[model samples]
Target chain A: MNEQSITLKKKPNLGRRIGDEIKRNFVLYLMAIPVIVYFVVFVYLPMYGLIIAFKDYRPFNRMGQGGIWGSPWADYYGFGNFVKFFQSPLFWSVIKNTIYISLLGTCFSFPAPIIFALMLNEIKNLKYKKIIQTITYLPHFISMVVICSMIIRFFQTEGILTKLITLLGGEKQNYMINEDAYRPIFVGSGIWQGVGWGSIIYISALSSIDQELYEAAVIDGAGKWKQLVHITIPGILSTIVILLIMNIGSILSVGYEKTILLQNDKTASVARVISSYTYDLSFGEGNSDFAYSSAIGIFQSVVNIIFLTIANTISKKVTDSGLF
Target chain B: MVYKPSIGEKVFNLFNILFMALMIFICFYPFWYCVTCSLSKQADTASLMLLPNGFTLATYKDVLAREAIQKGYLVTIFVVVVGTIINLIMTTIAAFLLTRKNFAIRGFLTWMMLFTMYFGGGMIPTYIVYTQILGLEGSILVLLIPGCISVYNMIVMRTNFNGIPTSLEESVKVDGGNDMHVLWHIIIPLSKAVISVMVLFYGVGHWNSWFNASLYLQGTEIQPLQLRLREILILGQTAAEGDAGDVSTMAENIKYATIIVATLPILLVYPVIQKYFVKGVMIGAVKG
Candidate 1:
C-alpha cells in the first residue's frame, strides 16, 4: 500500500505538466496567438528568406519560376557573391568611407553630449538650463528629411553658410559637393541633432550621484575642480563606459537614410558606405542584384555582431560591466 | 559653512554663460531662418538671412495649395493615427501577456521577441519577403503592418507592467476577472505614463518614416509627407521645377515653406509632450 501511494504521488511528466498549464491558462495563450503569428510571418519568415544570400537569387528569371526556392546555389560552393564583393574595387573604398565616417562621428559626436551635460550641470540657474535644453532638443524631433533639407540649403552655393564662408575668405561654392566637407558635415549635423537628447541620460546619471560625497569633498578642502575630477567623473564613469561600448558596437551601422538624402553625384565617392552600396545594388536605378546585395547585407550584420561581442568582452574586462 | 568662488571660477562662469548663449543662438537660428525665409517673398529670399526680408503669406498659400502636399498630409495623418493605435494595441497585449508570471511559455515568448533585437533579416531579404512573397509592394499596409510592434518598446512596456503589484492582479483574478480585465483595470491604469511615451515614440516614428515608403511605394500615389518633401527639397522637383517662369525663382521659398508645414505639428506639440519624452528616456536608461 505504501509503495503504491509513492508511485501515485509522483508528479506528472514535463510534457503533461506543460499541457496542463496551457489548458489552465488557455485564455492567455489565445491572446498570444496574434503576436506569435505576426512575428513568424514578418520577422522569422524573412529570416528564412536570408538563405537567398547564398543562392543565385533571380527575381524575374526568363526561363523558370522566380523565387528564393527556385534559385540555384551560387558559384564556388555558395561563396560567389561574397567573393565578388571582396574582389571589386568598390569594396575597399566603401569600407574605408564607412570606417572614416563612423570614426569621425565617434571622435566628435560621442563626446559632445558628455561635455554638454557636464557644462549644463554647472549652470546654477534653473530657468536658463531649461530653456537651453528645450531649444537644443528641438532638432532631434525634426524629420531627417527636413534636417537634410536644411543642411542642403545651408550649404548651397548661395546659402547662408556659404556666404559666411565667403566672408571668412573661403571660395564661394556648394560645400555639400566637396568631398573634404562630407565627413565634417555628417558628423557636425549628427552632433547638432543628437547631443541635447543624448545628454539626458548622462544628466540623469549626474543627478543621481550622491550629494553627500560632494559635501564631504568640500569639507575635505577639495576645490570645485578637484571635486569634479575625483567625485563627479568617477560617479558617471560606468554610464560613460556603457554608452561608449554600445556606440562602438554599432560603429559600422551608420544609417543610409541620411547618407542617401545627403549625397549628390559629386560627393557619391565619399558618401557611399556599406548600407548605401547595398541599397544601390538592390534598388538603385537599373540595378537589381538581389543575391549580391543580400551577401553584403549579411556581411555587414555579421561584422556588426562581431564588433558588439568584442566591445562587450573588452568592456567587461576593463570596466567590470557589460551589456549582457 | 559659506563657500566663495575664486577669480578663476568667476571668469569661467562668465565664459560658460556666453558659450551657452552662443549655443542657444546656433540651435534656434536654423529654424528661425527657415521660418523667415518661408515667410519672405521671392525676391526677398535671396537677401533673407537675419530676419524676414519681406513678409508674405503667399509661400504658405502656394505650398498648401499644391495637390501633392494635401494628399501627402492626408496619407501621413492616416498612417500616424492608425499605425499608432495598432502599435499600442499590439504592444499592450504583448506586454500584458509577457508580464504574467503564471502564464506558461512567457520566458520562451520573451526570448523569441528579444532575439530579433539582435539579429534581423537584413534589408534585401526582408524586402523580398515584404514585396514579392507577402505582396505588400504598393500597399500602404506595407508601412502599417510590418512594424506593428517595436520589440524595444514592448520590452519597455513589459518592464513598466512588471512594477505593478501582483496582489492587485490577484484581487482582480479572485473577482473572476480574466486577463483582459486585469489588463484593462490593473495594468493599463497603472502604466499610463509608459503608454503615453509609447504613443509619442511610435507616432513620431510613423510620421518621420520615409525610407521604407520610398522602397516599397516608390511610385504610389499614397506617399507620405516626408517622402514628398524629399522629392521637392532634395531632388529639386518642385511643381515649379519644370516651368521657366518667374515662379521658378520662388522655389527656395516654397521649399522652406514645405519644411515648416511638415514640421509645424511636431514643433507645436513638442513642449507639451517633452516631459513624457524625458521620462521615457529615463525609463529606458534604467534598463540599459
Candidate 2:
C-alpha cells in the first residue's frame, strides 16, 4: 500500500501540480481573459503591421497594392527608408539634438529631487515641510497643455518673469526666441515642475533607513552633516542607482509632445528630435509620410532599447542594481 | 522629536526655510498669475501680471457654460470610475492567483505581463488594431480596454500579494476551500491597501489620459475633461489666429481653474489614500 501511494504521489508531482493549479485558479484565469485578448489584438497582432515599414504602404490599396505580407518589391525596400533617413542632412543633427536635450534635462532634473528630498528630510517643523511639499506637488498634476501654455505666456515679451529679470539688471531679452536658451528653459521648467513630486519616492526611501543607524552615528559623535553623508546617503544608494539606470535607458526620448507644443519657427531647428520629425512628416505639411515616420519610430525605439540594455548591464556590473 | 539646533545649524535652518519658501512661491506663482489673468478685464489683461487688478468669475462661468467642457467632464468621470473598477478586479484576481504556491504557470504569466513594458507596437499600429481590427473606435470601451492592465501596476500588485504570508493560503486549503472561495473571503479582505493604490494609479491615469481619446474618437463627442482642456489650452495657444484679445490673457484664469478642477478630485481623494500611495511607491521603487 505504501509503495503504491509513493508511485501515485510521484505521478502528481510538479507538472501535474501546475495543471491542477490552473484548474483551481479557473476564475482568476477568466478575469485575465480580457487583458490577454486586449494585448493579443492590440499589441501582438499589430507587430505584423511593422512590415509596412518595408513596403510602399498605400492607404487605398492596402491589400492588393502590397499587403504587409505579400507586397512586391517590399522586401527590396529593406533598409531603403533607413538609408534615406541616415543620408538625410537632418539625421546627424536629429541624433545630436535628441541626446543633448535628454542628457541636459536628465542631468538637471534628476538631482534636483534628491536634493529637495534631503532638505525636506532635514526640516524640523512638520507644518512648514508639509506646506512646501503640498505646493511643490501641485504643479505635477497640471495638464501638460496648460503647463506649456503657461510657459509660453510667462516667457513672452513684457511677461512678469521678463520684468523680474530686467529689474535684476539683466536686459529684457526674448529668451524663448534664442535657440541657446531652449535647453535651459526645458530643463529648468522640468526640474521645477517635477522635483517635489519626484522627491516623494526618495523621501520614502529615506524614511525606510534604519533609525538605529542615525542613533549609532550620534553616539560616535558624528555631526548632522556626517550622519547625513555616512548614514542617509548610503541608505538610499540602491534606489538612486536603480532610478539612475532607468533614466539612462530612456536618454533619447526628449518627450516630443512638450517640445512640439513649445516649438516656434526659431526653436524648431534645435527642438526637432526623431519624435517631432516623425510627427511632422506624418501629420504636418512637410511630407505626410506615414510609412517613413513609422520606420523612424521603430528606429528610435530600437536605439532606446539598446541604450537601456547597456545601462542595465553597466549598473549590474558596477552597482549590482538593475531593472532586470 | 524636540531636537535643538546649534547656532550654525540654526543659520542653515533659516537658509533652508527661505529656500523652501522661495521654491514654494516660484511653484505657486504661475497658477496664481494664470488665475489673475483669467479674471482680469480682457484687453486690460494683456499687460497684466502678478495679482489680478479686477477679480471676476466670468471665465469660470464661460468655461462651465461651454457644452463641450461639460460633456468632457462627464466622460472623464465615467471613464475614471469604470476604468478603475475594471483595473481593480483584473489586478486583484491576478494577484490572488500569484499568491498560490501550487500555481505552475505563475512565472510564465508574470513574464507575459512584463513583456509589454519592453516592447509594444507603436501608436499607429495599435490605433489600426483598435479602429480597423477591433472596430471599437469612438466607443467608451476604447478608453477602458486598450490600457486595462498596465504591466508595471500588475507587477506591483503581484509583489504585494507575494508579501502576504503563505500560511494564509495553506490554512484555507486545509479547510477544503476552493480557490474562488479563498480569494473572495480571505485575499480580497486582506489586500485592501494595495487595491486602493492600484485604484489611484488607474484613476489618475484615466483622468489625465487624452492622447488615446484624441486618437480614437477623432470626430465623436467623446471628449474627456483633459481632452477638452487640452484643445483649449494647447491647441488654443499654438494656433491662436481666430481671436486677438491676447489669447494668453483669455486663457489665464480659466486654465488655472480648469487645472484645479481636473486635479481637485484626485487631490481630495489623495490624503485619504495617501498612506497607500506612499507605501506602494516606496516598495515599488525599491523592488523595481
Candidate 3:
C-alpha cells in the first residue's frame, strides 16, 4: 500500500488533479459559470468583432450573408481605413484638439484637486471643513447633461458668465459658440465638477500620515508653508504619483459624452474630439463608415496603451512604485 | 502643547477663510441659481441674481406636465432600479468568485477581466456587436446588460471581500454549510458597507448615463431623463435662439426647471449617503 501511494504521488497527472479540484468544488465552479459566460459574450465577443476594423464592414450584409466575416477587405492591404483617416484634415484637427484638451486637463484640473485638498487640510475647523466638502461634492454627482446645460445657459449672450466677461472688458458674445472658449469651458467646468470628489483620496492619504512628522516639523521651527512643503506634500506624494500615472495613461480617452452634449455646429470645428468624431463617423447623420470609425478607435486605443505603458515604466523607474 | 501663532499666520488664516467662502459660493451657486431661476416668473428670469425675483412653482408644473418628461422619468427609474439590481448581483458573484483563494483559474479570470479595463473593442465594433449581432437596437436591454459588471467596481468589491477573515467562512463550513450559505449569511452580511457603496455607484451611474441611451435608443420614446433634459436644455436652446417673447422667456424657465427636476433626486439622496462614498473612495485607494 505504501509503495502504491508513493507511485501515485510521484507521477500525479495534471488532468486528474484539475478534475479532482473541480469535483471537490463543484458548487463553486457552477457559480463561476455565469461570470465566465458573461465575459466571453460581452467582452471577448466584442474583441473578436474588432476584426471589422480590417474588413469593410457593411451592416446590410447580415451574418451568414457577407457580414463582418464575409465582407470585402479594406483597400491598402487592410489598412485603407487608417490610411484614409491619416490623409483627412479632420484627423489633424481632432488629434490636435484631443491632445490640447487632455494636456490642459492634466495641467489645470489635475492639480486643482491636490491644491484643494491641501487647502482643506489646513483648515482646523472641522465643521466648516465638512460643510465645504459636502457642498463641493454635489457637482460631481450632477449629470453631465445637466452640467453642460448649465454651462450653456451661463455662457449665453445675456448669461451670467457673459455679463462677467463684459464686466472684465470683454465683448458680450455668446462664449459657447466662440472657438476660443471651448477649451476653457470644458477644462474649467471639469475642474469645478471633479475637484471635490477627487480630493477625497488625497484627504484620506493625508489623515493616514503620521502626526509625529508634523510635530517634528513644528519642533524644527517650521512655519505653515514649510510644513506643507516638507511634511504634507511628501506624505501624499505616492498617492499623487499613482493617480498621475493613471491620468496620464488615460490622457487620450477624453470622455466623449460631455463633448457630444456640449458641442454645436459652430463649435464643432474646435470641439471635435477623437471619440466624438468616431461616434459621428459611425452613427452621425448620413455617415455610417463603420470601418473608418473603427480604425480611428483602434488608433486611439493603441496610443492610450502606449501612453499607459510609458507612464508606468517611467513611474516605476523614477519613484520605484507603479500601478502594475 | 499650545503654540503661539505669528502675525503672518493670522493674515494667512484670514485669507484662507475668504478663499473658502469664495469656493463655497462657486460650488453652491449653480444649483442655487437653478433653483431660483426655476422658481422665478418668466419676466424675472433675466434679471435674476442672488435670490428668486418672482417666485412661482408654475415652471415645475409646466415642465412635469410634458408627456416626454413623464416617460423619460419612468424609463430612468426602471433603468436605475433594475440596472442597479443586476449590477449588484453580477458584481457580488464575480467578486465572490475571484476572492476564492483555491478556486481553479482564479488568476487567469482576474487577468482576463483586468485586461478589458486597459483595452476594449472601441465604439464601432461594440456598437455593431450590440445593435447588429445581438439585435439590441432601440432596446433598453442594451443599456442594462452591456455594463452590468464594471471591472473596476468588481475589483474594489473583491478587495473589500478579501479583508473578511477566513475564520468566519471556515465556521460556516464547519456547520456543514456550503459556499452559497457562507456567502449569503456571512460574507454579504459583513460587507453591507461596501455593498451600499456599490449600490450608490451603480445607481448614480445608471441615473446619469445618457451617451449609451443616445446611441442605442435614439429617437425612441424610452430615452432617460438626462437625454430628455439634453433635448430641452441644448437642442431646444438652439432652436429657440434669437427669439424675444414671453414664449422664449417661459422656455428659459422650463430649462431651469428641467435641470432641477432631473438633478434633485440625486442631490437629495447623496448627502445622506456621502460617508459611504468617501469610504468607497478609501477602499479604492487601498487597491491603488
Candidate 4:
C-alpha cells in the first residue's frame, strides 16, 4: 500500500516534468485563443452586465446607472418587480398558457419522434425509409417565418386544410385567428416540424442495440413487439432518461421566438409566454422596462433551475440517470 | 402460410397505418399548399382552395424583381458565409484544445464554457455590451460576433475529438510531428464527420438567423433575407386583411413571391446535404 501510494504520487510528476506543456502544446493553445477570447468577450464579460437587472437601466443613461454595483440595490425594494409581476393579472394566465402549451407539446410532440423512430425501425425497405425520412426532415430546416407563413396560408378559409376540414364535416372557422386554437396550432405545428428530425437521435440509439439480441429473440419464438418492449426500450432507457431530464430542465423555454412569430393580438391572450412578454416589455415602444423584464427573466430562469434540479434529483433516485 | 391477423392485431395495424398516414399528410400538406398557392393566380390565391385555380408565375416574377429583396439576398449570403466560417474556426479549435487531457487547466477551461450554458446576462446588457462597448450596433458584425461559439457545438466537437484513437496521436508523434501538424494532418481528417456536423448545424443556424439582424442592423440595406421575407409576409397579410392602407395590391403579389424566393433555395439545397446531416446528428447524439 505504501509503495502504491508513492507510485501514484510520482505519476503526476512524471506527466508534469515532461516539459513546459504549454510550450510543447503552444499550437493547441494558439488554436484555442480565439475561442477563449470569444467566450470571454461574448459570454462571460456580458455576464457581468446581468447586474443591470438590479439597476434602473436606461440605454442612454447606462454610465449613470452607476454601473451595476453602485446602483441602488434591489434589496431595499425587496423583490419589488417580482411582486409586481406576480400581482399582475397576466401572470397567472400566461403561466397557465405556457404550462398548458408546453405540457401539450411534451405529451404529444416529445414521444412523436420516438414513435416515428419505432415505426421507421419496423420498415425493412431501406430506400422507402430513406425517402420518407428525407421528406419529413425538410420542415425542420425551414425557417420559422416561412413555416408560419405556410401555416397561415394553409389554414385560411379557402385553403386545402380548411377545405379538407369542411369535407370532413368540421366547421370552416379560421382557426389561426382564434385564441382557443393557439395551443392546438402551436403544438400541432411543432410536432409536424420536429417529429421527423427528432427521431434521428432515437434511430441512432435503436441502431446501437446489439443485433444478436434481436436474432436471439427471434430464435426464442419472440415477436417484433416483444423484442422491442423487452430489449429495445431497455437499451435506449439511459439515453431517453438523459434527454428527458434535459427537456425537463428547459421546460420553461417553450421555443418562444417561434411562438412570438406565430402570435397575433387575437392569439396573444393564450399564446403570450414569459419570453414573449419579456420581449414586449424590452422592445415594446412604451417605457423602457428593462428592470421589470429582467426581473421576470430572472424569475423564469430560477424556476427552470429549480425544476431542472428537482428533475435531476428525482431521476437519479428513480432511474439512476441525470445531468449532474 | 398467410400472415393472418387476429381482430385485435388487425385493429392495431389499422390504427398504426392511419396514424402514420395522418402524420405524413399533416407534416407535408402545408408546404405543398404554399407552393401551389404561390404559383396560383390572385383569384385562386384568394379562393385558397386545395388545387390552383390557374397557374401563373406572376407572383414569382414580381417578387424577384424587387430591389430590396435582391439586396437582402446578398446580405444574407454574406452573413451566412462569414458566420459559418467564424463558428467553425472557433468551435473546432476549442474542441481540439479541450481534448488534450494534460492541458493542466482543462477542468477550469471546461467549467468556464459550462458556466455560460446556464447563465446569461440577459438582453439589454448584452445589447449594451455589443452596441455601446463594442460599437457594433448598426454593423453586420453584430450578427456574426455575438454567437461565434455555441457551447453546445463546442461540447459535441470536443467529444468527437476525444473519441479519435490515442494510438493515432502516438504514431504521428513517432514520426516527429508537432501538435499543429498532427491536428491539421491527422485529427482534422479523422474528424470529418463531426466537422461536417458543425458545418451543417452552424451553416443552417446562420442561414436561418434573423432576430440578431433584426435587433442590430436596423439598416434596411444590410437586413438579411429572412428579415426581409418576414416583413413582407407580415406586411402582405396586414394589407390584404387589415385597413392598413398605404401599401399597393402589387406589394401583395410581391410578398407571396418573396416567400418563395426566401425559402426555395434552402429547400432545394437541403436534400443534397441532408445525408451528412443525419450522419452528424447520429454520431453527435450517440455521445451527446
A153-197 per-residue lDDT for model 2 (tens digits) = 666555566666677787776666668878788888889789988
Candidate 4 lDDT, A57-79, residue by residue in tens: 54556456444445565644547
DockQ of every candidate: 0.65, 0.46, 0.72, 0.54
lDDT of each: 0.88, 0.75, 0.87, 0.77
Docking class of 1: medium
TM for chain B in all models? 0.93, 0.85, 0.94, 0.90
TM-score of chain B of 2: 0.85
Worst 10 residues of 2 chain B by lDDT: B40-49
TM-score of 1: 0.95
Docking class of 3: medium
Judging by TM-score, tell me the better candidate of 3 and 4.
Answer: 3
Candidate 3 clashing pairs, residues 3+ apart or interchain: none
Alpha carbon deviation, residue A85, candidate 3 (Å)? 1.0
Clashing pairs in 1: none
lDDT for model 4: 0.77
Cα error of candidate 3 at position A175, Å: 1.5
lDDT of 1 by residue, A189-279 (tens): 9999998998999999999999999999989999889988999999899998888888888777788999999887778899999999999
Runs in model 3 deviating more than 4 A are: A1-15, A62-64, B46-48, B242-250
Candidate 3 iRMSD in angstroms: 1.4
